[model samples]
Target: MSNGNETAKGMGRRRGPMGGRGMTPGEKPKDLKGAIGKLASYIRHFKFAIVIVAVFAACSTVFSVIGPKILGKATTALSEGLMAKIRGTGGIDFTYIGKILLFVLGLYLLSALFSFVQGWIMTGVTQKICYQLRKEISEKINRMPMKYFESRTYGEVLSRITNDVDTLGQGLNQSITTIITSVATLIGVFIMMLSISPLMTLIALVILPVSAGLISFVVKKSQKYFKNQQEYLGHINGQVEEIYGGHLVIKAFNREQDTIEEFDATNQKLYESAWKSQFLSGMMQPIMMFVGNLGYAAVALSGGLLAIRGTITIGDIQAFIQYVKSFTQPIQQIAQVINQVQSMAAASERVFEFLNEEEEDQSVENPCDISKVTGAVSFEHVHFGYQPDQTIIHDFSVNVAPGQKIAIVGPTGAGKTTMVKLLMRFYDVNSGAICLDGHDVRSFNRRDLREAFGMVLQDTWLFQGTIMENIRYGRLDATDEEVIAAAKAAHADHFIRTLPGGYQMELNEDASNVSQGQKQLLTIARAILADNKILILDEATSSVDTRTEVAIQKAMDHLMKGRTSFVIAHRLSTIRDADMILVMKDGDIVEQGRHEELLKKQGFYANLYNSQFEETVA
Candidate 1:
């Protein structure tokens, strides 16, 4: 089991919802314009749909803006008829007022219909873009080099798929429509206010700078708190996930108190930042409402003076007051949309950065045919390093003929697993060549080259599926009879049958439902079913009891009768019958011979073999 600190280190940084908190300081894009440019290019294919959405949004805002002005005409006519009735000239004109009310209602209904159509189209477009981005990211994963994944955490890669994509989708859907409608409303309302009275229009305009200044002050004050809040939220989530995953290890080590104290520290920081940020964000609405009331007062006072001067009617005053309210709303919406754009740009940058990473060349000009490969392999003066400056395997050379059982014995970090990785072409040698049947391994396509060998590693891997399905993964077309036979040969059939569902037993994620030795047996059975020309077993029997190890050794012998086999083992007793034993130390072969011959030589191999017995006897 891993410790909590190691688990947290492996997880790296976690991210929350971008739309909820807006753009935190650390989450800002390095190059905002560049990221937006790339995003525009990516969505260029959907230009026609976007244009339609824009037209509909504009039409919706225009109709809504006109309704207030048209309804003001009804008010003016009603006011005139009341005065005329008092003078005995005319009563209220109910017929004319009803026509104006119906017309205004129709305009509002049209505005709602346009808003719905635009919303529907924008939603479809956003989903399509998200689908395409996910598809590309999935394909990119297959072509990325092994070193890229080895150097980064799984959570880091998964975030690009889940959190970043979700942010981009939600931001895109909201930002475009909000910008269009807000701008249209601002322009239309300003024109209507000016038509009523330029003096009142000027008064409403003066209050804008004051409202904008206060809003700016609130935003600046809240930004630092929001950044801190988001940062601690990520830390808190990572700590929780790490602690939960390694709970067993924590219990074994009796570190529960220490773990609780650490969590409390992080939780306290989160509480402090969260409440401060929320308090500041919550202040915006009340501030805007207060400023808006002042604007309403000024506009009403000016309109009253203009009515007394006989320059504007009662209906114009009403329409001008409504326009003042409408004007301030769009300004607030525009400010909010600016924050959403910043969040969207940051998410788009992350996604495009991943998509633009260097991809491994999965194809060659002329691939070698692997139809008749006979399992012969060689490493000629192979020199390699995970990093160029730090060479691990130096001047290594080896040769194996067809149908040979080669045992590689070594201590830990003796370049034992590194050799297997080189043979499989997971990483290429720096200064030499690995060959298959006299042809360079690089000459064959990666897929075809991998298909010729079967491997069972020390760590067994099983997905979430039935036992039969997991076994069938080795050879997709194998029949049930063949699978069962392979399991019997691997000594896994007996244990598998004892389970409640037998071969049909469902394994959860990680396959922790089975014992370690049983998991090892299942992997061995999978290798047997593959029936490849070459086999690589890295500590294949390390997890089993001595009796079970002996049984597996016998079965492995039968399986390797006429196939080229490479076995890596720390247990010296298990490989006595190997045709050749190559002892390695510090990335070089130190001794080679049959087991008895090496023991008789009383060299490094002899000392290693004798010490195991000495330790067991003590």
Candidate 2:
């Protein structure tokens, strides 16, 4: 199949993130600009390190020029001075020769030392850049909206953070400096070659322009392949994430071979692109060398003719050959740098795209710093939908006084959870307002507004840490005594005590080490521990066994006594004690009253109650 990106429009207003249900496929981000400038800004953070590397590189290049000059002088002196001594007159000027040889050796040593220094410094710079970039990317990921994650796979993002960024490190550390220094070194060598014998320089360089043309052509071709290769790698990574996350389903369906085939297709695409890129890029060195060797032969032949005719000395011809030998290697190095930049340019674009994601709107101004907000919530003709074209809640309204227990019961997709999301400002209403304590929630800082309420979602999220740490996450500054107290209050401390380490038991990745019931209890503990004036729960007790569910109901009773709680659950029997039950269909409340009062009304809530009542009798 063709790439989705290839077909995506550029900079289209389709504003949905990857993951879950997102917006319609809008304009693609290829319109994202200045990937090179973004990457360069990252390098700029290490200016001192760059300066040191560049300075050393310049010094090494300058020192490199002395090699051909010193060798030529020594050759000239040896040939003439030795002949003079052979004719037996002057003392042979052996002292001057010794000093010149010593200086040449010193220059070589200095060049070697500077090379080492530059490498050492650049390594440090690259590592730090990696650290900072990763840190910044992680922060951006946290702040991005849920919709953004809905549009792409986790592995694609991971590839950008890990593989893509590492590829750019080579360029930042050494390749750029190497190219700059090599250019300087090459120019110096070229001038010297010309001064020795301009006629031979002209002959040797006949093939140089052709070699350059071939390298440039290959670089242009390789760049496109490199970009395609990186994108293919991202697709492959996304496939891997999907396969692994759904490994159980694939196994149950006995589709291992099918999975392997799918994987192979993406893998092969990556391989083909990368292989083509490497093949073309690899040819650069050999082809340039072939032409360089031809240049060398031409120079050698022309210089010999001049030497024999006494038009130029043997020493000049000897030095010219050395310069010619050195020229091609630096030229090849430059070609490699160009190839490298293409790959890094693509990677930097992806990484920066992630960095520039629009964070969830936290644009509301900070409000009064009151310690406790009275739980008064009102949905005043609020309208909302994940997508604008499809309205989920239209002109809906609800109001709850402080400390009221409101249970929302509805058919699936009736905007139950969407209500909780809007109150938390995970999203804003398309029209109208959700108010808390007589103020629109959007008027307060999102963090402070969220602090007014607590949530226990259907899928509880526990980080890789101890149970104590996870609970402490509810209130970062909570004391140990308080954490244990909240755990006991949520009826989770009983299980915590049974574990080997009690509250200190470490949660494995995604909390897979714990039972589902235990996970739910911990999440409930978190909501209780939060001590918020407003509480929101979705399928809060769906994981608990009947007996534990009863126990949790008791725990929630104490926590719910003095807070405005909005509970969304499929289990209608669980919310029988709520002060009011609102039955919803589509996006409107069809029935609203106390549980018994709604049952007396024989509306949607009563019908839902009767359905569960029949399931029980069966």
Candidate 3:
């Protein structure tokens, strides 16, 4: 099968998802041995249990392997006794035949018992490994820098955590036992076949090259498509998630047909890769079986000739036939195990890539404590960029006194929210010092520094929980009464009281049950409850009506007392009473003053302020 990626590339379109960022297939790890070696470290903890499993697997396969040979003895004895009775020499040895039959039954039962125990042990080992992997991924996600998430799609990260890990665990569970059992059976069956007839053994050996060639050819042809299939699968999942999350936008914009076209393109690619992979990989078993039958024909013919020549008995020929059947069975199983291992290796590469991401530096060696911070903040000659080559914030500087309300107004992408991000230390400045109170912010622990500030963004976030619980998330120890007070202060208590279950009403996923404006109010209540010395409000009232905004502004006016607050807003009218206004454009502060002072200047801030009114006039 041809690689779909190469085909797509040949068509001049890059191999990726759809119109948006494509999730092309992950490259195979350059170091397969190293990747597998690291995976083994996770397995090493369960070595003792795995060793026990191996012992049982080996014993089970051995017992099963010996059964056919031992049963051949019974067949030979019965045949000899019958021949003797036919010659009128002696009656068949019925008691001896019964003893051999009972022995064979015992062997089969012992094999079954060992096989069952092996499976049970392996199940426990696989589950523990999966648990460890998931736990590590969860922790890794927390430690990862913001840049990592910004660069990768959320669905891609989630796929690593869920799909890749599951594949590794499930593949190991099935492949490990099959590998041990198949190898042991192959070895034992080979020895038994040799004992039965050397000629038959040689005939069976002829099938090995043919089977190997077929499997190798199919695997080589299909491996690339399998990799493509995995990538497209992730792309499909990512597209579906994006569409689902922004379905309202799609409908509003009449992008339903465009979305379907993009999805169909991705789906078409997925289908091409999937069918080709399945078709080629699936051809293995049937082809192997056909070759095995040819070997079987050859073996039977040789065994019959030997039997007629009195070189091998009919019972021995029968055992050799059974051995031949058992031999080919393990070869097929081994082929399957190899495929599973390759897939596991692919999955492990993704998991290891996540595990190996550069985590945020969280050292607290020279940490400064800000438990009693007074909310004075300063940005000293900050220089930074999201990308190294493209600087966004250039030599920006600002200082705010305690209990001051500063409003940041700017055009979109004019570095408005970026200032808040810098203050919160989400992304550190390339060269500068940000200080809280009198101490450098970097000197303070990230957790402690963030604890001093309360942020309410335009995009409200409420998890699936009761209204009370979502509010309480701000200050976990807050009493129910305290929560109600905070809600009242944010002008949300009246609405909450009217709900069917009041604070107990469950918020569904995405909190779609509540209006966007209501969600913003809850977030404001959360900020109020946090009671931090520093507050950052980013378009906090953008979603609410004029009446609601007035009420929210009144509540916020009370909340802002005795606290240093930074308000980022597009509506300059709301920030009229701010102690100071910093008008920014292209990552620089072009004008700064109180609203009245800036309006008199008639600069960039004036144009920005006047444009809103002009748009309204139009």
Candidate 4:
């Protein structure tokens, strides 16, 4: 079946558990409670800010309740008493009316002050949580194995760290406070209304449940759209990130039109889904308000009649009308806040999924602390693979003494690099053992074992920094003089000196400011300065020009001395003079000998060498 058919089938299956399978959402979904709990746990880290915001919210609610009650009471004073006529209560009683107005004015001032505090507290909480989650995500990625990265895109990972986390921030901080404050305001208004007239309150609440039920029904339908919107947005973010990073590749392959069409398709779907969700959610407030006001009118009409029949005073009826307005205001607020809850639940699931991933095994429980390592390597029946249950290396064994140079020769996918990866502890062996100086590699600490080798790869990634800083990356504490010396040793200084500011020269994104050859040599300089006892060059010169290859090879000769060096070769020219060469096939060493011995055997290595030697002559 096609991918689209598979995706449709999967989405259909997903709805069964998400309350999307003909299920009513009378309460929060079971999964949602856990998501809410996780968000609350993360939110509790900023308890001081939460407390400050809660206090401000409480002050605002108190002012709201008092301000309304006083205004109503001052209105009733005029109709109920001779004090209403003698003091002409409604018209400026600068002494008494002024006091009432002044008290209301004071409440407004306090409300404004607390509102500003609430805003600041909420902003701080969002920023702090976002910062903490971003930091945790970064650390988590570092711990994950290469397998996780291999199956995922740079774009997808980027979307999770950026877009998804931002969505979570909106939910965790601002959304939590919005829902809490709105609910609190609703409860406060309800109590005030009940105190005024239980009958009138009952009349106002009669249609409220129906309005809530309809608003909830609309939200339930739109929740699926919200999920779709978020999923498609992640896809869109991934696609856009890909296009921007690979603009040159798209332009080179004449794929611009196809790429643009793809982007438009993604963008349009997101636009439509977002529009549908927002439009549906937007309709909720107005419909609920309309129903609430209908109840409000009923309270006013019926209460006014009770006052005329002398069953209740005009003051009590007037107070009841004002209380009805307060009660309805909070219902409108509650309907609006429900969206925040739904959005956070979706984001929390993603964030937690990432955090819960199994990290790479770093279990060297009894780690040997090495003061100095004199590179001695032995592969005793060594076996390895990048994945579980898939053995790449079978009965592979070799011995390299200190100061020996070894070259590994193989085709593209013959596990040459995989062997190198194993040696570096980027992966552990499937079976057998790799040892250094008669100690199992696993017996030593990970950093110490890795620190024994300085490695250079085919593709060099230069961070956003200066020339000196990039070179200093190998040993962060290395001085400027040492950085320049390493650059000189690797033949990188000549080109670097030509650039503006020499050592201080800045590298743009991915070191695009410099040529590939320059970047490679700078990486070599980084490895050289570290001065490790072992060296690994994994097709390091394969991607560079002949001249650059010559530059790196010359540097390799100097560094390889007195160190066990493993160079995985693509060009046969470099391995002819090596002390030993191991020809690999399907993760096994098919042949191993000196260059002359391998050439006379006319085995796999001989054919590869002859083909390359012939190509050189031709």
CA lDDT for candidate 3: 0.82
Native-to-model Cα distance after best TM-score fit, residue 163 in candidate 4, in Å: 1.8
Let me know the TM-score candidate 2 reaches against the reference structure: 0.89
Write one digit per residue (lDDT tens) for candidate 3, span 1-618.
011111111212222222334644434445666768989999999999999998999999999999888888888888998899999998778788899889989999999999999999999999999999999999887667666765555566778878888878888999999998998899999999988877789889999998999889887777667666666666677777767777887888888998899899989988988888778767878988999899999999988888889998878888889999999999998887777777677678778878998987765787887777888888899888989898998788888899999999998989988787778776788888888887888887776777788877777778899999999888889999999999999899999989889999999988989987788788888888988888887788887899888887887887788999999999888999999998888998888999889889988888988998899789
Give the per-residue lDDT digits (tens) of candidate 1, residues 396-430. Answer: 88888999999999889888888877786767889
- Name the 10 consecutive residues with the lowest summed lDDT in model 1: 1-10
Ranked by TM-score, top first: 3, 2, 4, 1
TM-score of each predicted structure versus truth: 0.86, 0.89, 0.92, 0.88
- The regions of model 2 sitting more than 4 angstroms off are 1-33, 72-102, 366-372
How close is each model in CA RMSD to the real structure? 5.2, 5.9, 6.2, 7.1
Number of the candidate with higher lDDT, 1 or 4: 1
* Residue pairs whose backbone atoms clash in candidate 3: 17-22
| Deviation in Å, model 3, residue 170 alpha carbon | 1.3
Task: Arrange candidates, best lDDT first.
Answer: 3, 1, 2, 4
The CA-based lDDT of model 1 is what?
0.80
User: How far does residue 254 in candidate 4 sit from its true spot (Å)?
Assistant: 2.2
In candidate 3, how many Å is residue 436 off? 1.8
Distance from true location, Cα of 610 in model 4, Å: 1.8
lDDT of each: 0.80, 0.78, 0.82, 0.75
